[model samples]
Target: MNNPEVYDIKAKLEAIHQDIKRLMEKSNQEYLDIMLANLKNDLINSLTSYVSDDIEHGLHRGMVDPCQMRETCKSRFTEFLENNTSLIGQENVSKNIIDEKRAELDEIRETAPFDKCDICFSEVNSLFEKQLNLISSRQIYSNTEKKQTEISSIPEELMVKSVLEPLSNKQRLQILKSMASETMTFTALSELTGLRGGNLLFHIQKLLESDLILQRHERGDYMITKKGYNLLLMLSNFLKFLEK
Candidate 1:
């Protein structure tokens, strides 16, 4: 038998290791979320603008030419779909991988002899669900008049509100600001913002859900999306307009 103090110390060390592992996992997740958000936004912006430009150019060339506009829209839409199919495919793959991992982790927790904590399992579940939702909600908007018509029917205020809702918090704003400069891992973002990994992940998930940010390149490091940059610009403009 070991001394009580020795066992206590060992227990403390094991707890510390577990905590570190959780932090690392959460940090990695944050980075991926940010990158995906960026990719989704960029794709949407690219497709939308490309389609819109083609329509406008076609109209200018032949104001009364319905056939020309139709041809232009069709071509642009085809290009957008082709380029983005690969991205959509990747998103599906990532979601599947994450879902599988979550299932495996759940099974491990269920079968392991060690006492599993409910709170830890719940957190893990929530994180995985959030990512999966983000993947599903991720969309690439096209500039075709039909698509634009759909977007236009939705109130602009509602669109702004949806995007701004996730970014309303001070901590989230700080994280976005840090991401605006360069892509950083979740651990890096947490350190910069002085936020713990779990807390940071919660806010990041909100942003991801709102399509204000994205997760990209899921292996070890992550990248931000162009939509995020456009968001930063929108925020800056809103602030400037308020000041003026």
Candidate 2:
């Protein structure tokens, strides 16, 4: 491919990239804040049940000892926090926040039969941890959206089969991506792809047949076409989906 082809593809893809940025600027805060509020309230309810056996019947006796019940309740709630089931961040729920929460919960504990139990609620705030390799999903709506995938449906004139078949090979795909910003000489291509002579020519020929790239002659510099660059951009967008 030549310098002109390289510039053409880069210019086109850069424009599309900006448009995608605008489309993905959706406000995720309102939804995230709502979820956070519901989560805290639900957690309070669950903790209340865990600490108290019978809220309606204060005069009734239960078989479970108070000490055992308190330890079990704390461990259960702490494990749930450590698990991160609701995507609540451990950092977001800090030490100070936990202490404040425990103090508040202790006050809530004094209501009715709950006051009879001597269980301290400190562990409720202290056991948050990273769970199941999940990260904070609060910014979920800020990622590449489902609509971005519509670009995959290429028209026949763009030579869909020819273009994608070449890109299917990792080395050929790399060769095209290497030409995104500038044309690459044969020697430079060989070094980047780690393939020399005839072996390198095989992948290069596939891209040429697809017209996804331009070359001066049999062994000249290579540059990506607009079609090729957009394919790279598509793959990049898809990868962003995987990351989310």
- Per-residue lDDT of 38-157 in model 1, one digit per residue for the tens? 986787566446544544443345322344344443343344323333343352344344455556666745743323334333433443443344335553222233654797698777
List runs of model 1 lying over 4 Å from the truth.
Answer: 1-161
Would you give me the overall lDDT of model 1?
A: 0.60
Worst 10 residues of 2 by lDDT: 54-63
Tens digits of per-residue lDDT for model 2 on 118-161? 32332232222222212223322223234335545546655556
Candidates in order have lDDT scores of 0.60, 0.60
The TM-score of predicted model 2 comes to 0.36
Q: Which pairs clash in model 2?
A: 1-214, 1-222, 1-223
Best by TM-score: 2
